[model samples]
Target chain A: MAGERVQPATLSRSEAALVASEGKAPRTERGRKTLRAILDAAAIEFGEKGFHEGSISGITRRAGVALGSFYTYFDSKDAVFRALVRDMSDQVRDHVAPAIRAAPDQIAAERAGLSEFIAFVRGHKEIYRIIDEAEFVDPESFRLHYATTADRIAARLKAGAARGEIRADISDVHAWAIMGMNVFLGLRYGVWQDDVSPEAVADSIAEMLARGIGTK
Target chain B: MAGERVQPATLSRSEAALVASEGKAPRTERGRKTLRAILDAAAIEFGEKGFHEGSISGITRRAGVALGSFYTYFDSKDAVFRALVRDMSDQVRDHVAPAIRAAPDQIAAERAGLSEFIAFVRGHKEIYRIIDEAEFVDPESFRLHYATTADRIAARLKAGAARGEIRADISDVHAWAIMGMNVFLGLRYGVWQDDVSPEAVADSIAEMLARGIGTK
Candidate 1:
């Protein structure tokens, strides 16, 4: 059942392009920074007021960029919202990539990924709101975000299996299971409350992954 | 880190009462069936058009009930949406509870729960849209739904541990992890596609629970 083809992460260039509105891709370094500002401000606007109530002006005000700059990069509130969803998805991948890369093995890679993810989420609590809102605001983006994330995870796990660092039987089910564990764990430890540290959360998950949770 | 208290599922009567709008609880068997009809209709309405576009009239029309019947059970569209969120949550619990109760062990119980859950999602695909929309439309219900579900899972795991059917170290983390896995797996195999059987998905998870996925 695990024979499905897994795509490489480098194909994200097309994804980055998708993050920009039609005819709105930035050409210069300054334009890129302004686009970044608009997306960040959007995160706050939609995150706080939701999609219907959130306006382009609110994003521009928070971004401190002119209305013209906003229009130059985004067609409208909906466009920017879609862009923000993709951007947030990218932000999480970028934030967690280094830790995942630095880990010594597959299990440790997952641990580092979760720890870094929780830390990132704590700093960007608005992330959950933005991403969750995408489910209603832009269904396609919502679907794409999870689909790509799960695909990336499956690809990585498959590589680890080939290297003999992970169970050879690892498949999409394991990938989705790991992703789900990281997501809920992040929601509980990162967004809702912070009584526990990220390292501690990662440690518990690492132990669980190292051995089954059965009593036998 | 896993010492948090997990309340029992029986506390859901208070939750059900909380789901109803003020002065809208059904008092008779007929009223209860009417209320059930309204909720089922609301699921289709919201599921098809979303919260904003879904209307009481659409729901009443689908339910083949009178307009007064909707008002008899719900104060407004918002009230019914909130109620619907809780209703879906309860529907899932009631749907999965029997299988869980009939299992021979905690791990089997979990397997049964996931299998039943996926099957339920397949039949009630609207559930994802309605429950996810609650995050924006009715934030409290959304939080309550997840918090209650996680608490129930934790409580079950704790009971299983006491009975020597599960690892004693199980706690909120494990509960959340399991819930997360079941949810994503459902989204993938249940809502997104049906190429894989529910039994296959549940079996994979049951094996993972029985033994860790680590190469060693």
Candidate 2:
């Protein structure tokens, strides 16, 4: 529900590599492309119709994957879902982190981060709906989604505090508060409407944080 | 499901009175109690099962009223939902306004308002689940809720501006933002979990607004 795919599993890169290698060999690059297609179709189907309503046959039809090959890649529908969430979470983290690194200062970092986050959400709106529904399918995914991003932001805030840039006394609780607010607001305003651009909403939120409600 | 009671209608007071009065003798206090019991039962059933899962039979059973008597107060389940939302909205407003009025200063009024709002939600947590779920059942009810609360806070902000307590240029949009943030945060931290006291959460928010997030 935090706008991207998430997993509770803390698989290391090596473990992920081993799992990828162990998966049934789809002999050609074309076969690999088909796997990606299946994941994408599954995400849309699950998100729109929900877990209970989305059918494996419908998903295979949408992806143009052979029904037999679905078993080759995943143990079951749940496995496909777990894989999709992890992939999406990785994609989101990769998409947003570099933008933060590119900015020269705290304020600029926040601006870049917000803009990139908004752009990411706009670009992958469908996957977000799936992620939002993850709470019902597997609550741990939702909890991990918040925890991953909250931990990231909390780490940064802690670093800033150590450097004397942020208030020393501010708790990780407040960091989570900011993270939680931005997330829920993005879900409500970004995913659900076209009236306001995500970029504009992101800017407004960045402004609220960098300054706040009080007059400067 | 927000784990609270919510319904999908926005009935004005006169409309509610008209609906409640339908098919009931005016002198019958028993009728009034039966009507309230039906509404309360509806709230519980909706909260537990959501709009799609809740049935009129279940509601009447919970209310301990004859199944036929259900139609005496409401035309359908939807009507009952409308009445429930309207009733809760009025109850929340009634609970908050007097406390605000009795406070000694604007800050006190604000604090009182937040406390009363929290207390109201705590008191009616079950009913709140029904209202929150109504967001999906009917967007109009949610929209009416946002607009009503925004207008109230906007008026208060205007008063604060006139008294030179707040920045004059602050818009109703900001009022909406504050109202949205406070209410949602309360829902997340208060009703969702009791990890923090509602008063502390309100104080943190109130303090943030008053002093801003910058170095003092």
For TM-score, the strongest prediction is 1
Which lDDT tens digits does candidate 2 get at residues A1-216? Answer: 222544222334443432232455355565566666667777777866667688888789987878987776677777677666766777677777888788665545656766666566665666655665554456576657756776787787666567655555555445555665555445445565556665666565556555542122
True contacts kept of each: 0.63, 0.08
Residue pairs in steric clash, candidate 1? none
For residues A47-157, write the lDDT of model 1, one tens digit per residue.
Answer: 788889999999999989999988887787888998888888997898899999999887888889999998888878888888888888788998999999999999988
Candidate 2's residue-wise lDDT over B92-173, tens digit each?
7777899888976555566678776776676566655666555545557756775687788778867876776655555544
On DockQ, the leading prediction is 1
lDDT for model 2, on a 0 to 1 scale?
0.63
Residue B58 in model 2: lDDT: 94
The regions of model 1 sitting more than 4 angstroms off are A1-18, A212-216, B1-19, B213-216
Candidate 1 chain A minimal-lDDT segment of 10 residues: A1-10
Question: What lDDT does candidate 1 reach at residue A66?
Answer: 90
- Give per-residue CA lDDT, model 1, range B125-211, as digits (tens): 889888888888888888899899999999998898888877777778888888889889999998899988999989888888866
- How good is the docking of model 1, as DockQ? 0.48
